[model samples]
Target: MNTPHIAASRRTGFFSRSGVRRLAVALAAVPVALLAAGCSSAKSSSDQSATDVINKLGAVPIPSAPQTQLTPSADESHPQLVAVGSAVAVTLPSGTGTITALGPTEDLPTPLPATMPTQVAGTITLRVATKTGTVKVTTTDLSSRDDHGNDIALTPVGVAQAAATAGGTADFVVRGTFSSGAAQITLREDGHVVAVWDFNIELD
Candidate 1:
Protein backbone atom coordinates (compact mmCIF):
# COMPACT_ATOMS: atom_id res chain seq x y z
CA MET A 1 0.00 0.00 0.00
CA ASN A 2 2.97 2.43 0.69
CA THR A 3 4.19 2.53 -2.86
CA PRO A 4 6.34 5.44 -4.30
CA HIS A 5 3.38 6.81 -6.24
CA ILE A 6 1.20 7.09 -3.09
CA ALA A 7 3.95 8.81 -1.13
CA ALA A 8 4.51 11.33 -3.93
CA SER A 9 0.76 12.14 -4.06
CA ARG A 10 0.63 12.88 -0.28
CA ARG A 11 3.67 15.13 -0.47
CA THR A 12 2.18 17.02 -3.43
CA GLY A 13 -1.11 17.52 -1.61
CA PHE A 14 0.59 18.92 1.50
CA PHE A 15 2.66 21.38 -0.52
CA SER A 16 -0.40 22.54 -2.51
CA ARG A 17 -2.33 23.36 0.69
CA SER A 18 0.53 25.27 2.27
CA GLY A 19 1.27 27.18 -0.96
CA VAL A 20 -2.39 28.25 -1.27
CA ARG A 21 -2.38 29.50 2.33
CA ARG A 22 0.82 31.49 1.75
CA LEU A 23 -0.59 33.01 -1.44
CA ALA A 24 -3.74 34.04 0.38
CA VAL A 25 -1.80 35.78 3.14
CA ALA A 26 0.38 37.61 0.62
CA LEU A 27 -2.66 38.80 -1.36
CA ALA A 28 -4.39 40.08 1.77
CA ALA A 29 -1.36 42.11 2.87
CA VAL A 30 -0.95 43.95 -0.44
CA PRO A 31 -3.97 46.24 -0.16
CA VAL A 32 -3.15 47.19 3.42
CA ALA A 33 0.40 48.12 2.47
CA LEU A 34 -0.80 50.17 -0.48
CA LEU A 35 -3.36 51.94 1.68
CA ALA A 36 -0.73 52.89 4.24
CA ALA A 37 1.61 54.18 1.54
CA GLY A 38 -1.18 56.20 -0.04
CA CYS A 39 -2.15 57.76 3.26
CA SER A 40 1.42 58.74 4.05
CA SER A 41 1.99 60.31 0.64
CA ALA A 42 -1.28 62.27 0.80
CA LYS A 43 -0.45 63.67 4.22
CA SER A 44 2.99 64.80 3.13
CA SER A 45 1.65 66.54 0.05
CA SER A 46 -1.09 68.28 2.04
CA ASP A 47 1.39 69.49 4.63
CA GLN A 48 3.70 70.91 1.99
CA SER A 49 0.85 72.73 0.27
CA ALA A 50 -0.27 74.27 3.56
CA THR A 51 3.25 75.42 4.35
CA ASP A 52 3.60 77.09 0.97
CA VAL A 53 0.34 78.92 1.39
CA ILE A 54 1.29 80.18 4.84
CA ASN A 55 4.67 81.40 3.66
CA LYS A 56 3.11 83.29 0.79
CA LEU A 57 0.53 84.93 3.00
CA GLY A 58 2.90 85.80 5.81
CA ALA A 59 5.65 87.44 3.74
CA VAL A 60 3.75 90.59 2.84
CA PRO A 61 6.16 93.16 1.37
CA ILE A 62 6.45 96.71 2.61
CA PRO A 63 5.48 99.62 0.39
CA SER A 64 7.99 102.08 -1.04
CA ALA A 65 6.33 105.23 0.24
CA PRO A 66 6.05 106.17 3.87
CA GLN A 67 2.88 105.16 5.70
CA THR A 68 0.24 107.85 5.94
CA GLN A 69 -2.04 108.64 8.86
CA LEU A 70 -5.25 110.57 8.23
CA THR A 71 -7.57 111.93 10.85
CA PRO A 72 -9.61 114.09 8.38
CA SER A 73 -10.44 116.71 11.00
CA ALA A 74 -9.72 117.45 14.63
CA ASP A 75 -13.45 117.22 15.31
CA GLU A 76 -13.65 113.79 13.67
CA SER A 77 -14.16 111.06 16.23
CA HIS A 78 -12.55 108.26 14.17
CA PRO A 79 -8.89 108.38 13.14
CA GLN A 80 -7.26 106.21 10.45
CA LEU A 81 -3.60 105.20 10.27
CA VAL A 82 -1.95 103.58 7.28
CA ALA A 83 1.11 101.37 7.49
CA VAL A 84 2.63 98.89 5.07
CA GLY A 85 2.77 95.24 6.14
CA SER A 86 1.08 96.12 9.40
CA ALA A 87 -2.46 96.45 10.73
CA VAL A 88 -3.87 100.00 10.76
CA ALA A 89 -6.06 100.73 13.78
CA VAL A 90 -8.79 103.35 13.99
CA THR A 91 -11.40 104.27 16.53
CA LEU A 92 -14.83 105.09 15.20
CA PRO A 93 -17.48 107.10 16.95
CA SER A 94 -19.28 103.86 17.76
CA GLY A 95 -16.35 101.45 17.90
CA THR A 96 -12.58 101.04 17.80
CA GLY A 97 -10.36 98.52 16.00
CA THR A 98 -7.79 97.68 13.38
CA ILE A 99 -7.70 97.17 9.61
CA THR A 100 -5.10 94.88 8.10
CA ALA A 101 -4.38 95.05 4.39
CA LEU A 102 -2.96 91.76 3.22
CA GLY A 103 -1.04 92.72 0.13
CA PRO A 104 -1.31 90.88 -3.17
CA THR A 105 0.81 87.75 -2.95
CA GLU A 106 -0.73 85.53 -5.61
CA ASP A 107 -1.76 86.11 -9.17
CA LEU A 108 -5.20 84.81 -10.00
CA PRO A 109 -6.29 83.09 -13.19
CA THR A 110 -9.23 85.37 -13.79
CA PRO A 111 -9.81 86.59 -17.29
CA LEU A 112 -8.85 90.22 -17.87
CA PRO A 113 -9.86 92.77 -20.43
CA ALA A 114 -7.47 94.00 -23.09
CA THR A 115 -6.73 97.13 -21.12
CA MET A 116 -5.90 95.25 -17.92
CA PRO A 117 -2.19 94.65 -17.39
CA THR A 118 -2.09 92.26 -14.41
CA GLN A 119 -4.58 91.00 -11.90
CA VAL A 120 -3.69 90.33 -8.26
CA ALA A 121 -5.55 89.05 -5.24
CA GLY A 122 -5.58 90.28 -1.63
CA THR A 123 -7.56 90.31 1.65
CA ILE A 124 -8.66 93.04 4.06
CA THR A 125 -9.70 92.35 7.62
CA LEU A 126 -11.64 94.84 9.74
CA ARG A 127 -11.96 94.42 13.45
CA VAL A 128 -14.23 96.82 15.26
CA ALA A 129 -14.92 97.21 18.94
CA THR A 130 -18.30 98.85 19.21
CA LYS A 131 -18.60 101.54 21.79
CA THR A 132 -22.35 101.43 21.95
CA GLY A 133 -24.00 99.51 19.08
CA THR A 134 -23.25 97.42 16.01
CA VAL A 135 -21.55 98.94 12.95
CA LYS A 136 -22.74 97.88 9.53
CA VAL A 137 -20.15 97.30 6.82
CA THR A 138 -20.83 96.56 3.17
CA THR A 139 -18.80 95.73 0.09
CA THR A 140 -19.53 99.15 -1.42
CA ASP A 141 -17.77 100.76 1.52
CA LEU A 142 -14.38 99.69 0.14
CA SER A 143 -12.43 101.07 -2.81
CA SER A 144 -8.93 100.94 -4.31
CA ARG A 145 -6.90 103.54 -6.17
CA ASP A 146 -3.72 103.41 -8.21
CA ASP A 147 -0.86 105.87 -8.09
CA HIS A 148 -2.06 107.62 -11.23
CA GLY A 149 -5.13 108.78 -9.27
CA ASN A 150 -7.19 106.34 -11.29
CA ASP A 151 -9.48 104.05 -9.36
CA ILE A 152 -8.76 100.35 -9.59
CA ALA A 153 -12.01 98.45 -9.31
CA LEU A 154 -12.11 95.86 -6.54
CA THR A 155 -14.18 92.83 -7.46
CA PRO A 156 -15.33 91.00 -4.36
CA VAL A 157 -14.29 87.36 -4.47
CA GLY A 158 -15.50 86.42 -0.98
CA VAL A 159 -16.75 88.05 2.17
CA ALA A 160 -17.24 87.05 5.81
CA GLN A 161 -19.45 89.45 7.72
CA ALA A 162 -19.61 88.77 11.41
CA ALA A 163 -22.16 90.25 13.76
CA ALA A 164 -20.63 93.65 14.55
CA THR A 165 -20.51 93.07 18.25
CA ALA A 166 -18.73 95.32 20.72
CA GLY A 167 -15.53 93.56 19.65
CA GLY A 168 -15.57 91.40 16.56
CA THR A 169 -13.86 91.14 13.19
CA ALA A 170 -15.07 90.93 9.59
CA ASP A 171 -13.03 89.93 6.57
CA PHE A 172 -13.16 90.55 2.82
CA VAL A 173 -11.29 89.17 -0.16
CA VAL A 174 -10.85 91.40 -3.20
CA ARG A 175 -9.44 90.86 -6.66
CA GLY A 176 -8.30 93.57 -9.05
CA THR A 177 -6.18 94.16 -12.12
CA PHE A 178 -4.08 97.26 -12.64
CA SER A 179 -2.92 99.11 -15.71
CA SER A 180 0.64 99.73 -16.79
CA GLY A 181 2.80 102.04 -14.64
CA ALA A 182 0.85 101.28 -11.49
CA ALA A 183 2.87 102.40 -8.50
CA GLN A 184 0.69 102.46 -5.37
CA ILE A 185 -2.54 100.99 -4.02
CA THR A 186 -4.81 103.08 -1.84
CA LEU A 187 -7.69 101.62 0.15
CA ARG A 188 -10.64 103.73 1.08
CA GLU A 189 -13.64 103.14 3.30
CA ASP A 190 -16.79 105.18 2.73
CA GLY A 191 -14.96 107.73 0.50
CA HIS A 192 -12.15 108.36 2.97
CA VAL A 193 -8.71 106.82 2.60
CA VAL A 194 -7.82 104.38 5.37
CA ALA A 195 -4.73 102.57 4.12
CA VAL A 196 -2.22 102.85 1.27
CA TRP A 197 0.31 100.29 0.05
CA ASP A 198 2.84 101.31 -2.56
CA PHE A 199 4.15 98.91 -5.19
CA ASN A 200 6.52 99.19 -8.10
CA ILE A 201 4.30 97.20 -10.43
CA GLU A 202 5.78 97.23 -13.91
CA LEU A 203 3.69 96.16 -16.88
CA ASP A 204 4.92 95.66 -20.39
Candidate 2:
Protein backbone atom coordinates (compact mmCIF):
# COMPACT_ATOMS: atom_id res chain seq x y z
CA MET A 1 0.00 0.00 0.00
CA ASN A 2 1.23 3.45 -0.95
CA THR A 3 0.22 6.79 0.65
CA PRO A 4 -0.04 10.03 -1.37
CA HIS A 5 0.68 13.46 0.19
CA ILE A 6 -1.05 16.64 -1.15
CA ALA A 7 0.89 19.84 -0.50
CA ALA A 8 -1.25 23.04 -0.37
CA SER A 9 -0.02 26.21 -2.15
CA ARG A 10 -1.36 29.28 -0.41
CA ARG A 11 -0.77 31.22 -3.67
CA THR A 12 -4.40 30.66 -4.62
CA GLY A 13 -7.22 33.26 -4.63
CA PHE A 14 -7.71 35.89 -1.95
CA PHE A 15 -10.61 34.14 -0.25
CA SER A 16 -8.70 30.83 -0.22
CA ARG A 17 -5.13 31.88 0.65
CA SER A 18 -4.93 35.65 1.13
CA GLY A 19 -4.70 35.34 4.94
CA VAL A 20 -1.71 32.96 4.87
CA ARG A 21 -0.04 35.05 2.15
CA ARG A 22 -0.71 38.24 4.08
CA LEU A 23 0.87 36.81 7.18
CA ALA A 24 3.90 35.47 5.36
CA VAL A 25 4.35 38.68 3.36
CA ALA A 26 4.05 40.82 6.48
CA LEU A 27 6.71 38.76 8.24
CA ALA A 28 9.09 39.03 5.26
CA ALA A 29 8.42 42.75 4.69
CA VAL A 30 9.08 43.82 8.30
CA PRO A 31 12.85 43.46 8.08
CA VAL A 32 13.11 45.30 4.77
CA ALA A 33 10.81 48.02 6.00
CA LEU A 34 12.85 48.47 9.15
CA LEU A 35 16.08 48.58 7.13
CA ALA A 36 14.70 51.28 4.80
CA ALA A 37 13.26 53.31 7.66
CA GLY A 38 16.56 53.18 9.50
CA CYS A 39 18.65 54.30 6.50
CA SER A 40 18.64 57.96 7.58
CA SER A 41 20.36 59.19 10.73
CA ALA A 42 18.30 60.74 13.50
CA LYS A 43 17.80 64.51 13.23
CA SER A 44 18.94 66.86 16.01
CA SER A 45 16.34 68.34 18.39
CA SER A 46 16.44 71.71 16.54
CA ASP A 47 15.97 70.07 13.15
CA GLN A 48 13.15 67.90 14.44
CA SER A 49 11.32 70.92 15.81
CA ALA A 50 11.73 72.84 12.57
CA THR A 51 10.30 69.95 10.56
CA ASP A 52 7.45 69.42 13.03
CA VAL A 53 6.24 73.01 12.58
CA ILE A 54 6.05 72.58 8.78
CA ASN A 55 4.90 68.97 8.70
CA LYS A 56 1.54 70.02 7.24
CA LEU A 57 3.13 71.93 4.39
CA GLY A 58 3.67 70.21 1.05
CA ALA A 59 5.80 71.35 -1.89
CA VAL A 60 6.13 70.24 -5.50
CA PRO A 61 8.49 71.19 -8.30
CA ILE A 62 7.42 73.57 -11.05
CA PRO A 63 6.42 71.88 -14.29
CA SER A 64 8.18 72.13 -17.65
CA ALA A 65 11.67 73.20 -16.73
CA PRO A 66 14.69 72.80 -19.01
CA GLN A 67 17.48 70.48 -17.83
CA THR A 68 21.12 70.94 -18.79
CA GLN A 69 24.36 69.00 -19.13
CA LEU A 70 27.89 70.09 -18.17
CA THR A 71 29.23 69.85 -21.78
CA PRO A 72 28.84 71.48 -25.22
CA SER A 73 25.70 73.05 -26.72
CA ALA A 74 23.14 70.59 -28.12
CA ASP A 75 21.66 72.81 -30.81
CA GLU A 76 22.32 72.19 -34.52
CA SER A 77 23.51 74.94 -36.89
CA HIS A 78 21.27 75.40 -39.94
CA PRO A 79 19.79 78.04 -42.25
CA GLN A 80 16.60 79.61 -40.86
CA LEU A 81 14.09 82.38 -41.62
CA VAL A 82 11.40 84.33 -39.79
CA ALA A 83 8.45 86.40 -41.10
CA VAL A 84 6.14 88.91 -39.49
CA GLY A 85 2.86 90.79 -40.07
CA SER A 86 0.83 89.95 -43.17
CA ALA A 87 3.90 89.12 -45.25
CA VAL A 88 7.65 88.91 -44.62
CA ALA A 89 10.23 87.65 -47.11
CA VAL A 90 13.76 86.29 -47.00
CA THR A 91 15.86 85.63 -50.09
CA LEU A 92 18.45 82.81 -50.22
CA PRO A 93 20.98 82.98 -53.10
CA SER A 94 21.47 80.01 -55.42
CA GLY A 95 23.89 80.25 -58.34
CA THR A 96 22.79 79.27 -61.85
CA GLY A 97 22.63 75.47 -61.71
CA THR A 98 20.41 72.56 -60.77
CA ILE A 99 19.33 72.61 -57.11
CA THR A 100 17.75 69.59 -55.46
CA ALA A 101 15.90 69.79 -52.14
CA LEU A 102 17.03 67.70 -49.19
CA GLY A 103 14.92 65.58 -46.85
CA PRO A 104 12.38 67.24 -44.54
CA THR A 105 13.99 69.48 -41.94
CA GLU A 106 11.79 70.76 -39.07
CA ASP A 107 11.70 72.40 -35.69
CA LEU A 108 10.37 70.30 -32.80
CA PRO A 109 7.20 70.72 -30.75
CA THR A 110 7.18 74.44 -29.99
CA PRO A 111 5.20 75.37 -26.90
CA LEU A 112 2.04 77.22 -27.86
CA PRO A 113 0.90 79.38 -24.97
CA ALA A 114 -2.39 80.16 -26.65
CA THR A 115 -4.38 78.95 -29.65
CA MET A 116 -6.70 80.25 -32.47
CA PRO A 117 -6.30 83.98 -31.78
CA THR A 118 -2.55 83.89 -31.26
CA GLN A 119 -1.69 82.48 -34.72
CA VAL A 120 1.49 80.41 -34.15
CA ALA A 121 3.79 80.11 -37.17
CA GLY A 122 6.75 78.07 -38.45
CA THR A 123 8.69 77.22 -41.67
CA ILE A 124 11.71 75.21 -42.80
CA THR A 125 14.70 76.74 -44.65
CA LEU A 126 16.74 74.85 -47.23
CA ARG A 127 19.72 75.71 -49.43
CA VAL A 128 21.12 74.25 -52.62
CA ALA A 129 23.54 72.19 -50.50
CA THR A 130 24.82 70.36 -53.59
CA LYS A 131 23.71 71.14 -57.12
CA THR A 132 23.07 68.38 -59.64
CA GLY A 133 21.53 69.93 -62.81
CA THR A 134 18.77 72.41 -63.67
CA VAL A 135 16.33 71.59 -60.86
CA LYS A 136 12.86 73.12 -61.00
CA VAL A 137 11.26 74.41 -57.78
CA THR A 138 7.82 75.23 -56.34
CA THR A 139 6.04 75.83 -52.99
CA THR A 140 3.15 73.85 -51.53
CA ASP A 141 1.14 73.94 -48.25
CA LEU A 142 -0.79 70.86 -47.09
CA SER A 143 -1.77 71.68 -43.48
CA SER A 144 -5.44 71.87 -44.59
CA ARG A 145 -6.17 73.66 -41.29
CA ASP A 146 -6.85 77.02 -42.86
CA ASP A 147 -8.56 79.79 -40.85
CA HIS A 148 -10.34 82.46 -42.81
CA GLY A 149 -9.54 84.91 -40.02
CA ASN A 150 -5.86 84.02 -40.42
CA ASP A 151 -4.52 84.26 -43.96
CA ILE A 152 -1.11 82.67 -44.63
CA ALA A 153 0.22 82.86 -48.18
CA LEU A 154 2.99 80.77 -49.76
CA THR A 155 4.53 82.25 -52.89
CA PRO A 156 7.46 81.17 -55.03
CA VAL A 157 9.09 84.53 -55.64
CA GLY A 158 11.73 83.30 -58.10
CA VAL A 159 12.36 80.56 -60.63
CA ALA A 160 15.47 78.71 -61.88
CA GLN A 161 17.31 81.74 -63.29
CA ALA A 162 20.58 81.03 -65.07
CA ALA A 163 22.51 83.95 -63.56
CA ALA A 164 25.81 84.28 -61.74
CA THR A 165 23.91 84.58 -58.39
CA ALA A 166 20.72 82.75 -59.35
CA GLY A 167 18.58 80.44 -57.23
CA GLY A 168 14.89 80.05 -56.30
CA THR A 169 13.10 82.17 -53.71
CA ALA A 170 9.88 81.75 -51.70
CA ASP A 171 7.83 83.73 -49.16
CA PHE A 172 5.35 82.87 -46.37
CA VAL A 173 2.77 85.31 -45.02
CA VAL A 174 0.52 85.13 -41.93
CA ARG A 175 -2.55 87.33 -41.95
CA GLY A 176 -3.77 89.12 -38.78
CA THR A 177 -7.26 87.63 -38.73
CA PHE A 178 -5.81 84.32 -37.45
CA SER A 179 -7.46 83.20 -34.20
CA SER A 180 -5.02 85.60 -32.49
CA GLY A 181 -3.66 82.84 -30.30
CA ALA A 182 -1.44 80.11 -31.82
CA ALA A 183 -1.09 78.26 -35.11
CA GLN A 184 1.45 76.29 -37.18
CA ILE A 185 2.91 77.03 -40.64
CA THR A 186 4.31 74.23 -42.75
CA LEU A 187 6.12 74.82 -46.07
CA ARG A 188 6.77 72.08 -48.59
CA GLU A 189 8.30 71.72 -52.07
CA ASP A 190 7.06 70.03 -55.28
CA GLY A 191 8.29 66.47 -54.63
CA HIS A 192 10.87 66.49 -51.80
CA VAL A 193 10.49 68.69 -48.72
CA VAL A 194 12.86 71.54 -47.87
CA ALA A 195 12.53 72.96 -44.35
CA VAL A 196 10.36 73.76 -41.29
CA TRP A 197 10.66 76.67 -38.85
CA ASP A 198 8.60 77.47 -35.77
CA PHE A 199 7.54 80.81 -34.26
CA ASN A 200 5.84 81.48 -30.91
CA ILE A 201 3.46 84.43 -31.39
CA GLU A 202 1.64 86.41 -28.73
CA LEU A 203 -0.72 89.36 -28.81
CA ASP A 204 1.06 92.66 -28.64
Candidate 3:
Protein backbone atom coordinates (compact mmCIF):
# COMPACT_ATOMS: atom_id res chain seq x y z
CA MET A 1 0.00 0.00 0.00
CA ASN A 2 0.96 3.67 0.27
CA THR A 3 1.81 3.10 3.94
CA PRO A 4 5.50 2.55 3.05
CA HIS A 5 5.66 5.95 1.32
CA ILE A 6 4.07 7.68 4.31
CA ALA A 7 6.58 6.03 6.69
CA ALA A 8 9.44 7.08 4.43
CA SER A 9 8.18 10.68 4.43
CA ARG A 10 8.04 10.68 8.22
CA ARG A 11 11.61 9.41 8.42
CA THR A 12 12.75 12.15 6.07
CA GLY A 13 11.01 14.81 8.18
CA PHE A 14 12.75 13.54 11.35
CA PHE A 15 16.17 13.64 9.64
CA SER A 16 15.50 17.16 8.39
CA ARG A 17 14.64 18.35 11.90
CA SER A 18 17.84 16.83 13.34
CA GLY A 19 19.97 18.39 10.63
CA VAL A 20 18.42 21.81 11.30
CA ARG A 21 19.19 21.47 15.01
CA ARG A 22 22.85 20.58 14.28
CA LEU A 23 23.16 23.54 11.93
CA ALA A 24 21.73 25.89 14.57
CA VAL A 25 24.17 24.65 17.19
CA ALA A 26 27.09 25.18 14.80
CA LEU A 27 25.94 28.70 14.02
CA ALA A 28 25.65 29.54 17.72
CA ALA A 29 29.30 28.54 18.26
CA VAL A 30 30.55 30.93 15.56
CA PRO A 31 29.99 34.12 17.55
CA VAL A 32 31.71 32.70 20.59
CA ALA A 33 34.68 31.71 18.43
CA LEU A 34 34.89 35.15 16.90
CA LEU A 35 34.72 36.85 20.30
CA ALA A 36 37.51 34.67 21.62
CA ALA A 37 39.64 35.43 18.58
CA GLY A 38 39.10 39.17 19.00
CA CYS A 39 40.10 39.07 22.65
CA SER A 40 43.26 37.13 21.84
CA SER A 41 44.19 39.58 19.12
CA ALA A 42 43.68 42.56 21.40
CA LYS A 43 45.87 41.08 24.13
CA SER A 44 48.62 40.27 21.65
CA SER A 45 48.57 43.81 20.30
CA SER A 46 48.80 45.27 23.78
CA ASP A 47 51.75 43.08 24.63
CA GLN A 48 53.53 44.11 21.45
CA SER A 49 53.11 47.80 22.21
CA ALA A 50 54.49 47.33 25.69
CA THR A 51 57.49 45.49 24.30
CA ASP A 52 58.12 48.24 21.80
CA VAL A 53 58.06 50.89 24.48
CA ILE A 54 60.46 48.91 26.63
CA ASN A 55 62.82 48.51 23.71
CA LYS A 56 62.65 52.21 22.93
CA LEU A 57 63.67 52.86 26.48
CA GLY A 58 67.04 51.28 27.00
CA ALA A 59 66.18 49.97 30.47
CA VAL A 60 63.00 48.66 32.02
CA PRO A 61 61.42 50.24 35.07
CA ILE A 62 63.51 49.67 38.14
CA PRO A 63 62.53 46.49 39.96
CA SER A 64 63.03 48.08 43.36
CA ALA A 65 60.27 49.74 45.34
CA PRO A 66 59.32 53.22 44.23
CA GLN A 67 61.02 56.00 46.14
CA THR A 68 59.30 58.91 47.85
CA GLN A 69 57.79 61.68 45.78
CA LEU A 70 60.39 64.30 44.94
CA THR A 71 59.66 67.97 45.31
CA PRO A 72 61.61 69.75 42.60
CA SER A 73 63.60 72.81 43.55
CA ALA A 74 63.00 76.17 41.97
CA ASP A 75 66.68 76.78 42.35
CA GLU A 76 68.40 75.38 39.26
CA SER A 77 71.85 75.73 40.83
CA HIS A 78 71.13 72.76 43.08
CA PRO A 79 68.50 70.48 41.63
CA GLN A 80 67.57 67.43 43.64
CA LEU A 81 68.38 63.96 42.46
CA VAL A 82 65.39 62.02 41.13
CA ALA A 83 65.46 58.30 41.48
CA VAL A 84 64.32 56.07 38.66
CA GLY A 85 60.65 55.08 38.87
CA SER A 86 60.05 57.76 41.47
CA ALA A 87 57.37 60.43 41.22
CA VAL A 88 58.15 64.13 41.19
CA ALA A 89 55.72 66.70 42.56
CA VAL A 90 55.87 69.92 40.55
CA THR A 91 54.11 73.24 40.80
CA LEU A 92 52.61 74.13 37.47
CA PRO A 93 51.46 77.60 36.53
CA SER A 94 47.82 76.65 36.79
CA GLY A 95 48.13 74.29 39.74
CA THR A 96 50.12 71.21 40.65
CA GLY A 97 51.48 68.38 38.49
CA THR A 98 53.54 65.22 38.73
CA ILE A 99 56.29 63.72 36.60
CA THR A 100 57.77 60.26 36.91
CA ALA A 101 60.91 59.02 35.21
CA LEU A 102 59.73 55.55 34.34
CA GLY A 103 63.07 54.31 33.02
CA PRO A 104 65.83 54.64 30.42
CA THR A 105 65.34 53.98 26.71
CA GLU A 106 67.69 53.82 23.72
CA ASP A 107 66.05 52.04 20.81
CA LEU A 108 64.56 55.20 19.39
CA PRO A 109 62.82 54.87 16.02
CA THR A 110 64.75 57.91 14.80
CA PRO A 111 68.28 58.91 15.62
CA LEU A 112 68.74 61.39 18.45
CA PRO A 113 68.98 64.85 16.94
CA ALA A 114 72.55 66.02 17.46
CA THR A 115 74.88 68.46 15.80
CA MET A 116 78.08 66.63 16.66
CA PRO A 117 78.66 62.98 15.95
CA THR A 118 76.72 61.47 18.82
CA GLN A 119 75.24 58.12 19.70
CA VAL A 120 72.02 57.72 21.61
CA ALA A 121 73.26 57.15 25.13
CA GLY A 122 69.85 56.71 26.75
CA THR A 123 66.38 58.16 27.11
CA ILE A 124 64.10 59.10 29.97
CA THR A 125 60.52 57.92 29.62
CA LEU A 126 58.29 60.23 31.57
CA ARG A 127 54.72 60.04 32.74
CA VAL A 128 53.27 63.45 33.35
CA ALA A 129 50.00 64.30 35.05
CA THR A 130 48.32 67.60 35.68
CA LYS A 131 45.27 68.27 37.76
CA THR A 132 44.73 71.49 35.84
CA GLY A 133 42.18 70.55 33.20
CA THR A 134 43.63 72.87 30.58
CA VAL A 135 47.33 72.65 31.29
CA LYS A 136 49.63 70.67 29.02
CA VAL A 137 53.32 69.76 28.88
CA THR A 138 55.14 70.15 25.58
CA THR A 139 58.61 69.22 24.36
CA THR A 140 59.68 72.83 24.09
CA ASP A 141 59.10 73.21 27.82
CA LEU A 142 61.87 70.78 28.70
CA SER A 143 65.65 70.94 28.54
CA SER A 144 68.71 69.05 29.80
CA ARG A 145 72.15 69.90 31.11
CA ASP A 146 75.39 68.06 31.65
CA ASP A 147 77.36 67.88 34.87
CA HIS A 148 79.70 70.65 33.78
CA GLY A 149 76.81 73.01 32.91
CA ASN A 150 76.67 72.52 29.15
CA ASP A 151 73.42 72.09 27.29
CA ILE A 152 72.52 68.55 26.26
CA ALA A 153 69.92 68.85 23.55
CA LEU A 154 66.83 66.63 23.71
CA THR A 155 64.71 65.15 20.94
CA PRO A 156 61.18 64.26 21.96
CA VAL A 157 59.30 61.30 20.56
CA GLY A 158 55.92 59.68 20.97
CA VAL A 159 53.24 61.98 22.34
CA ALA A 160 54.07 65.54 21.30
CA GLN A 161 52.15 67.08 24.12
CA ALA A 162 50.88 65.60 27.34
CA ALA A 163 47.40 67.02 27.52
CA ALA A 164 45.82 65.47 30.54
CA THR A 165 42.40 65.67 32.10
CA ALA A 166 41.96 66.59 35.72
CA GLY A 167 42.65 63.03 36.78
CA GLY A 168 44.27 61.45 33.74
CA THR A 169 47.92 61.23 32.69
CA ALA A 170 50.03 61.10 29.54
CA ASP A 171 53.43 59.72 28.61
CA PHE A 172 56.31 61.03 26.51
CA VAL A 173 59.88 60.12 25.63
CA VAL A 174 63.02 62.28 25.25
CA ARG A 175 66.19 60.79 23.88
CA GLY A 176 69.59 62.40 24.24
CA THR A 177 73.26 61.57 24.46
CA PHE A 178 75.19 61.76 27.73
CA SER A 179 78.53 62.50 26.25
CA SER A 180 79.19 65.21 28.77
CA GLY A 181 77.58 63.17 31.54
CA ALA A 182 74.01 64.26 31.74
CA ALA A 183 73.17 65.53 35.18
CA GLN A 184 69.78 67.16 35.19
CA ILE A 185 66.59 67.50 33.18
CA THR A 186 64.68 70.73 33.63
CA LEU A 187 61.01 71.24 32.93
CA ARG A 188 59.46 74.61 32.45
CA GLU A 189 55.81 75.56 32.51
CA ASP A 190 54.94 78.55 30.33
CA GLY A 191 58.53 79.79 30.32
CA HIS A 192 58.78 79.45 34.10
CA VAL A 193 61.16 76.74 35.23
CA VAL A 194 59.25 74.37 37.46
CA ALA A 195 61.23 71.17 37.97
CA VAL A 196 64.62 69.55 37.54
CA TRP A 197 65.29 65.80 37.61
CA ASP A 198 68.77 64.53 38.27
CA PHE A 199 70.12 61.33 36.78
CA ASN A 200 73.28 59.30 37.25
CA ILE A 201 74.15 57.88 33.87
CA GLU A 202 76.36 54.79 33.64
CA LEU A 203 77.26 54.01 30.06
CA ASP A 204 77.78 50.47 28.76
Among these predicted structures, which one has the highest TM-score?
3
RMSD per prediction, one decimal? 25.6, 19.0, 24.3
Deviation (Å) of 103 in candidate 2: 23
lDDT per residue for candidate 1 within 129-148, as digits (tens), equals 34334543455656656667
Superpose all Cα atoms of candidate 1 onto the true structure and report the RMSD in Å to 1 decimal.
25.6
Best by lDDT: 3
Q: What C-alpha lDDT does candidate 1 achieve relative to the native structure? A: 0.49
Q: What lDDT tens digits, residue by residue, belong to model 3 across residues 97-138?
A: 667776466544355344533344677777867765544667
TM-scores of the models, in the order given: 0.43, 0.24, 0.50
Q: Model-by-model lDDT, in order?
A: 0.49, 0.33, 0.60
Which residue ranges in model 2 land beyond 4 Å of their true spot? 1-177
Q: What is the lDDT of residue 87 in candidate 2?
A: 21
lDDT of 2: 0.33
For model 1, the superposed segments whose C-alpha errors exceed 4 Å read 1-81, 108-136, 160-163, 180-190, 199-204
For candidate 1, the 10 contiguous residues with the lowest summed lDDT are 58-67
Using TM-score as the yardstick, the better of models 1 and 3 is 3
